[model samples]
Structure formats: C-alpha cells, structure tokens
Target: MSEGFEKCHNEYTLFTKTSKEGKILIVNLYVDDLIFTDNDEFMFLEFKNSMVRELDMNDMGRMRYFLGVEVLQRYDGIYISKIKYALEIL
Candidate 1:
C-alpha cells in the first residue's frame, strides 16, 4: 500500500517513486486483490517484491481474469472485457 508507493487520496491507488529513469508503476487495490502495471519490467519486479515483503500475499502471476472480467495480454497491450459474464447473463 503506502509502504513503497505513494498512496493516492482515492483509497486504493498507488504510484511508484518518482524518477525519470524508472518507469512509473501504478497499483490499484480491490479488497484482497491487487491489479498493478508498469512500463518498465525491472520497476514492476521491484514493486512486486516490495509488496510481497510488506504484505503476506501470493503473486498470482499475470492477470487473466478478475471479478468476472477477462484480461487478455497481448504484444500490443492489454484488453479487458466481460464477454463471459455477458454470455452467462444471456
């Protein structure tokens, strides 16, 4: 949470340490789950390790689904949708 990154007033938003060389890391917390992304791989790993050290939680690896939303990671970028939820509702 606020241990490593700067906490946003909006409750669950966190941003990595400011640095021109390091990519900014963004983290959003939803109850027990955390969704995080960074432009730099090293920065991401550093943040992840910090989280692990600060909080007792499992690293679920790459996010594929969360709260019924399907997360698809591609070379271009990430795509998120609730197609499965929509189908289920249908």
Candidate 2:
C-alpha cells in the first residue's frame, strides 16, 4: 500500500494514490469491507491483483449493495438508492 498511496488527513478510512500521469486510485475501508477504484484500467487491475495477493479476501466481483444502500453501475454513470432499506423497514 506504499506505492505512492497516502492516507487522507481527515479520513482514516480513505486512501488515495496518484499516477505520474495524474490518474487517481481511491480506496475506502469500512469495517472489513474494502472498495477501490481507479481511473486507469491497467493500474486498477494492478492494484486489485496486488491487494488480492497480499490479503486473504475474495473479490466479490462488482458491488451491488453496501451498508444497506443499493448501487447501480451503468455505462453512463453510477446510481445509488436506499429504497431497499426503506422497504425492509416497512
């Protein structure tokens, strides 16, 4: 995680790394779950692979839900909602 990654001063759970070309990779840790994304596909894969190799964690593929919030990733953009959470409470 030391490959130019720096901890966010205000957020201990957030880490960010920047490539020389200015591409950014972001990682967020919540409890035991980790979510990461990178602007560059090659770099993203490299980072993901590295993490998988070092940590005993499974890649659950794409994310659908997190912390009771639904996430929808579309070609156009990403969407999130709490409708499922609300329904469960009803």
Candidate 3:
C-alpha cells in the first residue's frame, strides 16, 4: 500500500486513505477477494494500477452482486437491494 494508506485500527483487512481534497478511498479484503471504491476518479485509477502492479489480481469491473446483495450504480447515486436473496429463499 502506498500514498499514505493506513490500516484500520479495528479491522486489519480494511485500508483507507483521504486525499488533501477530502476525497476518500476505502479497500476491504476477504481472503483473496478485494473490494475498493473511491470518490476521486484519478485516485481510483491510481490505486487500481498499484494493486495490479503489486498483485496477481484481475479487474472484475463494477460490482453487481456481493454477499447476496445486489448493487445498482447510477449516475444519480448507488442503490442496494436484497431482492435477489429474498427470491432465492422463497
């Protein structure tokens, strides 16, 4: 990790960094899966490039579903739903 990224005190698998402009980038790791999001587009690309350079990871692109939750990202905002999970249980 670079660019002053800091590990969370409460969670070892979580890392975060805040730019001087107050933009935040967060990354969480679970086993071999890594999830990350950033408010700054340039910062996001930088982190992605850094990770790709350092690890054998592939870009899965934007997340649609994770842990049974469906994610819908739109220009207005992001929306999350468990309708998919609920349908599976029924």
Candidate 4:
C-alpha cells in the first residue's frame, strides 16, 4: 500500500526504437509501482523485449506494476485507481 502518503502520483518512462526510428515517454512512479497508457501493441512488445535484452530483468509476463491500484485495460481505454490504498487507510 501507499502506507502513510496522502497523495500519490504514478510515474514511468518508456523508449521505443525500431530499426528505423525512435520515441520516448515520461510517466510517473511512486513507491514500487506504476501505470502507463499506450496501445501501440506491436511497437510496445518490441520495446519491452528491448528492455529485457538490456537489463537482466525477470519477465513477469504483463501487469508489471499495479501499485495497489486496479488496472482495467480494454479496447476502449484504461482504468486505474488507488482504491486499495484508500480502503487500507480507512
């Protein structure tokens, strides 16, 4: 959980590079988790693989960082909230 924090802002960063081009993103990360938004599936997996190759990371499939929040990703959009943290504190 967030423990004693009153407010939380998630952050994260991802870089995308193809054989021809490159891109970058900056998101939020607080505590040991994060939530990011993107739907470029093919490029997304490619970037994830690139990250795996660069760092000795244990690939835990997907759902990398839930941050004590709920992540609902769909064809429409994504849903995220710190409901768990709120409940814990209450």
Best prediction by lDDT: 3
Residue pair clashes in candidate 2: none
**Which lDDT values do the candidates have, in the order given?**
0.79, 0.91, 0.93, 0.46
**Candidate order, lDDT descending:** 3, 2, 1, 4
Using Cα atoms with residue i matched to residue i, what is each candidate's TM-score against the true structure?
0.78, 0.92, 0.88, 0.50
Q: Model 4 over residues 1-90: C-alpha lDDT tens digits?
A: 211112323312332222334333222344443323334565556545665687664545545237477666666766787877798899
lDDT comparing candidate 3 with the true structure: 0.93
Leading candidate by TM-score: 2
RMSD of each: 2.4, 1.2, 1.5, 9.8
Encode model 1's per-residue lDDT on 5-36: one tens digit a residue.
68776664555555477567777878777788
lDDT of 3 by residue, 60-89 (tens): 999999899999988889899999899999
Model 3 residue 6 CA deviation (Å) reads 2.0
- In terms of lDDT, which candidate is stronger, 1 or 2? 2
Q: What's the C-alpha lDDT at position 60 in model 1?
A: 84
